[model samples]
Target: MATPTVEKFLLEVSRVLRERNGPQLQDILVIEPPLPPLYNLMVNELRNAFPSGQDDALEDKCTRALPEYVEMEDGSSWTAFIKFMRQYFCFLRDVNVENLVETFQLLRNLVKQSVNALGHGSMGVVLLPTVIAFSRALTKLTIALHKKPQLIAHLIRRQAADESGSRSTLVDTAADVLRDAFSGCLNDRSVTGAGVGSDGRPMGKKISIYVIANLCLKLYFECDKIRSAEQIFVNIQNGSPPLSLYPASQRVTYLYYLGRYYFVNNHFYRAQLALQSAYDGCHSKCVQQRSRILPFLITACMTLGRFPSQALLRRPEAAGLAEKFLPICRAISRGDLATFRSFFGPEGPHTDYFLRRRLLLPLRDRCEVLVWRSMARKTFLLAGSQGDPGARKAPTFDLHDLLRLTQVLERRSFGQTQKKPIGKTHTNSIFMFQNSQQNGIKPELYVDPDVKGVAEPAGPPEPTMLDIESMVSSLIYQGFLGGFISHRQLRFAIRGAKEKGSLNAGFPNVWEVIKSRSSDAVPGWKRDEVSSVRNGVSRPPGPGMVIHLSGARPAGTPPM
Candidate 1:
């Protein structure tokens, strides 16, 4: 039964070819072919039957042949189908220059309907292949329409869908078709200068390049290949006619995407530079757009460890802008917890939401702020005890305090004393100074009666009394003269040493006699016979006074 049906179909196709006026030609050619060989034969027969000199009929015949072959399920059939369509479309392209406008219009309409059907979930296995065929056909049509402004406008209208409606899926499907078409055209390099310019000359559509780049970027970003998106941006930048060749607004848009790509990849330095350029390139008239750009700029600055420009921060025009970003800077500097929390809040258009939530906010609030606050407290304590007389008595900063603080701030469960003591050398210096003051002593006053009697010849006997209290007071006074110690503490140290007699006992009797003789202007006390007289005594020296009685000095003392 299938063989006879196929035979009857073949006979009808042959009859149409001979008569060339069959009303059912379109219907007959569009019927499903039976097998791979029969499919190829039918396609070849249709191709040969395309009317000569009648370009419209030839295109219609080829167009009608598309739906038939595109329905095949087998891979071989699909491949052959694609090959047949490509050859047929290329033939239409070459021969039907005048009739190309109407041919593309009809083809675009057919594919658009197919696209809509596929989007509505009407087509199942056939959808993918249909998309591929529609894409190929659209590419030829779009290229043909490039020379016809009326046709170009018509195609655009046909392609337009309700952008704000549930048309994204449709747009996406159409975008897929457009993407494949552009890819094919780019591969062949034949689409260049294929479109007609307003000047009525063939020119490449500059807008298409931007559209292609944007599509590629979107595709790559959705796939999470941020690096490839960045590379595409680089290519866009280094193109022969640079991205800057576009108008400022378009250029700004390009830079905007380029900057975001860098930002997403953590290329902060490049991101900052690119975003700054974009922000500046966009005019002030676009306040909303400027607002959108500001956060990215702020983030870029922060990541690069740079502060925002003063102009931006201080400008009255940027009031809301300052409110948005200044807290981020302050939080970073002071390690403030509340500010950090607000920075990562769920309200704004933050780019690195996950990082802020998972890492930066928690780290700052839970760890960094606590660590810095502890350090500040330690510094204040150290500064408070700068100078104390009994430095060892002063409480020193502790290493364990710092280490324990560190553990607490970092949320770690460890408490061990630090190996090195805090301010060790400084504490030691203070201790040594204290010990030296304790060991120091004062000199005693001594007077010799022998020298006192012989000093009558002088106008006045020089005072030989040593004021030990005064001498010790001078030393202690000098030590604490800086007003670091209270007067009561100074007096107590002096009085304590004197009461112990350590101050007076430090002087020797012989040294006292020498001092007394020197007071009386006696030249040599050691050589004088008074020294022998004093040495002869075995008993303890008298408490009141002792005079050395030398015979020669006694006779001439008054006279001398």
Candidate 2:
């Protein structure tokens, strides 16, 4: 049954292996010219075989003769293993799973035979090189198939959608195949443990993990497997050398995928830190990747009331975000709600992206802060101007007027966002929520034993200086409006001179704000009890609608 051409090749290889040392072993195999090639091919025939493509058939035919060559009196297992692997990679697409299984089995037999002949020293020296080559082949195979899992998903959804069989079946099959292969290989951490391979090198878990991470980087954008991928990263995070010890590109990609997972889950601080690390580690030549990460990075910073540094903003990769958000940034700093609305309106160009990313709610909160600060400034000016000319105490800005001011600012702010269909509903919902605050006698921060229970007003209690002051207190605590509320009057002023620079910088300079307040009221700093909820989060009472404060939380609880 043997082909005459293959019979000649096997006879030559067996003869050379019998007489050869390392140089002759290297040369006859034609591994490289400076090394020996003891038995690969006649020079003319080797020249005719070509480098790749159909030449894989020629290589496969030659490799099938490997065991025949090894069975010859003096032929060795090392030559058969190397020859089989070279042919396998060369004809990778055509190789079946059974053939692959046979190959690893051959590897085990070959390595153990080498260990017996060369003694224990050969276990490390001989098997180490073989292990390295085996790893590279698996890595190469993994890289080749890396996109298949996602490709299968897309094909099912797009090309097979609506078919009677159901596209999900194909998708599930593809996911199952990849999941089993990747998980099994990566989970086996003890590569060199005695019983692992039984006869040879166990599959190296390190290379498998790196390879799977590469696939996950691609899969992350392709499907909903992020949670699984995140867990994989976590489980392997403490591996011997650590994932950080992987190639730089793999580490950067892992951080990016990890950061995106955290971002979607609303862990802003961790997301910010992870994204920043990814951005820092990004290669200089990878401009598009750097550009892709900028928007999420910008939004994460904004949610925490901060901005990326000017140096970071100046990069060409960040130009688009800087152009779109700079106006809102400046508006926030100036406490100019009108301009913030102009740039940040729901119908503005980037609105859908922000909403999809769940950043719109936080942006809306910042807008309220700007509007509330303006309202506070107006209240301060009115207090200075009105009431008795020689009055010892400043006249209170009427609760009615402040309520009306909030309505006007809210209307204008929402009006800008009203172009989109959902924008109208969002505006109406916020308006109704704020109006409810004015229709009741809300609890004040007062701890008076005499005022044991809230008095039920005959009708909704008209907004008072106490109610107004409570709204201000809530805003201060939430880090929305930077300045402190007056304990005596409901007046809101810009924070002390030193912190004026960072007032609307997004992050509240809390220590400065608290330091400016008198020490007397610090112990039981009054907190407004928010009675309203929208979409599950509590909102402060009155027009400016700050975020909720828990039951009687101390004012000092705000972080510096």
Q: By TM-score, who's the top model here? A: 2
Candidate 2 C-alpha lDDT tens digits along 411-515: 666666554564554345543444434546333433467766867554323455566667777776766555554565445444432333322432344334433
The number of the candidate with the highest lDDT is: 2
Tell how far residue 38 is off in model 1, in angstroms.
42
RMSD of each: 39.8, 18.8
| Residue range with the least summed lDDT across 10 consecutive positions in model 1 | 521-530
Writing each residue's lDDT as its tens digit, candidate 1 over 291-348 gives 6666676766554335576688765435555665566666544534333444454432
Per-residue error (Å), model 1, residue 429 = 69
- Cα deviation of 542 in candidate 2 (Å)? 48
lDDT of each: 0.42, 0.50
Scored by Cα lDDT, where does model 1 land?
A: 0.42
| lDDT score for residue 480 of model 2 | 51
- Model 2 CA deviation exceeding 4 Å by range: 1-186, 191-204, 238-240, 336-346, 352-402, 417-507, 510-560
